[model samples]
Target: MATLFVITLIATAIGSISGLVSGGYDGLFLGASTGLVAGVAAWAVALMVAQWRRERRLNRYFSQDGPVAQHVRQNQRS
Candidate 1:
């Protein structure tokens, strides 16, 4: 998935940078493992946040005070 790829890229970049700063390939491997965990965590959080926002928007759209509800009320009056 695109989400996974983006997260992995970012994680890899951070891991590689940290690894290079600390030493050689050993650091790189450690950083990479850390990055993988971080990326998956980030992706999960992102998914949760997105779903929450979408549900909220849908609820609002159908609520009595929402635009669609107001439009229906106005049409009924006419």
Candidate 2:
């Protein structure tokens, strides 16, 4: 969440500055809006990827061939 905010702020600042330099007031608004959308999209994609990776890791950890499963099997044999 914090990272998302930071990314949005940086993108908006960059867009606003560029727009101000190229097209004045109107450009600033357009650039800021575009930047905001892009930032949010980027953040969403990043979040999804992070979630997917975490789920994959957790699945692996709990799978039959995983360390936890092996430990349980060894304990049962004893």
Instruction: Work out the TM-score per prediction.
Output: 0.66, 0.83
lDDT of 2 at 17: 83
lDDT of 2 by residue, 1-78 (tens): 898889988888888888888899999998888888888888899899999999999999999999999999999999
- How well is each residue in 33-74 modelled by candidate 1, as lDDT tens digits? 888788888888888898999999999999999999999999
lDDT of candidate 1 vs native?
0.87
lDDT, residue 19, model 2? 82
Clashing pairs in 2: none
What stretches of model 1 exceed 4 Å from their correct place? 1-4, 64-78
Error of 2 at 12 (Å): 1.0
Error of 2 at 45 (Å): 1.2
The reply for model 2, stretches above 4 Å from the true place, is 72-78
